[model samples]
Target chain A: MARLAVDVMLKPEILDPQGQAIARKLPQMGFEGIAGVRQGKRFELVVEGPADEAAVERVRKIADTLLANPVIETYEVHVLSDN
Target chain B: MARLAVDVMLKPEILDPQGQAIARKLPQMGFEGIAGVRQGKRFELVVEGPADEAAVERVRKIADTLLANPVIETYEVHVLSDN
Candidate 1:
C-alpha cells in the first residue's frame, strides 16, 4: 500500500479567524518568540494499485471532489513511500 | 534555510468532531468512496545554525512550550528535505 499525503489550507489572502484567534492567544499561553501559527488539515490515504500516474489522478480526484473546498481553500499532494 | 516539518494533530482516541463532520459531509459533496478524513496541522519551520541534536531539542521544546497541547493533543515531528 502506498500513502498519499495531502494538505488542505485556507488561502493566505483570506482571513483565517480561527488561526487569528489561536495566534492571538499563543503569546498568552507562554509561547514566546513565536511569530505566527497557521492551522490546516492533512490527510494521509492508504492507496492501492500501482503507484503511478493513475494513482495520482485518483488521489487528486478525491481531493478535488470531496477533500477540499476549491473556492475558499486549496490542497497539495505528496506521494510518500510506497509498499 | 532548512525546514522541520511537524504534524500537530488531535490524539487518535480523542473525538475528532470536526473531522467526523467533514467525513460525514464529504460523500454528499460528491467525494465518493472516501472513508474518513482526519484533520491535523502540519508545521514547517526554517531554522538557522547547525541541524543537529540541539536543533531537535529546540524544535521539540517549541512543541512542548507553544506548538502542542499536552493534555488533549499530541504532535509528531518530521525533518523534511532541508535547503
Candidate 2:
C-alpha cells in the first residue's frame, strides 16, 4: 500500500473565521508575535497500490474533484510512501 | 517574518466521521482503489520573527498548548520559511 497526503486550504482572498479566532487567542495564550493563522484541512489516504507516478497523478485528480472546493479552496497532494 | 506549518491529526484509535464520509463517496466519484481516508487539520502560521531555532521551538510549544488538543489529537510542526 501507498500513503498519500492532501492539504486543502482557503484561497488567499477568502476569509477564515476559525483561523481568525485562533489568531485572536494567541496573545492571550502568551504567543504574542504570531499573525495570520490560516486553518485548513489535511487528508491522509492509504491506497492499495504502489506510489508510482501514475498513482500520484490520479490521487491529485481525486483531490481536485472530491477533496477540495475549487471556488474557494486549493489543495496540494503528496505521495508519502511507496510501501 | 517566517511561516510555520502545523498538522494536527486525530489519534489512530479515534473515529473520523468526516474522513469516512469522503471515503464512502470516492467510489461513486470513480476513485475506487483508495481506502483508509483520515482527515485532519492544518494550520499555516506566519510569525513576526525569523525562523530560527528559538522561534520554531516557541511555535512547537504554542502548538502543543493552543493549536492542538493533546487529548485526542497529535500535532507535527515544521518551519516552512525564514523570510
Tens digit of per-residue lDDT, candidate 2, span B30-76: 88798789999999999998988888888898889887899999988
* DockQ score of the complex predicted as candidate 2: 0.85
RMSD of each predicted structure: 3.7, 1.1
lDDT of 1 at B16: 80
Residue lDDT tens for model 1, A1-83: 66677888777777776666655765676554434445667876656655577767877987887678999888888886567
Best by TM-score: 2
* Candidate 2 residue spans exceeding 4 A from truth: none
lDDT of 2 by residue, A24-69 (tens): 9989987889878999999999998898887888788888888889
For candidate 1, the TM-score is 0.67
lDDT of 2 at B78: 85
Model 1's CAPRI class is: acceptable
- Quote the RMSD, in angstroms, for model 2: 1.1
DockQ of each: 0.33, 0.85
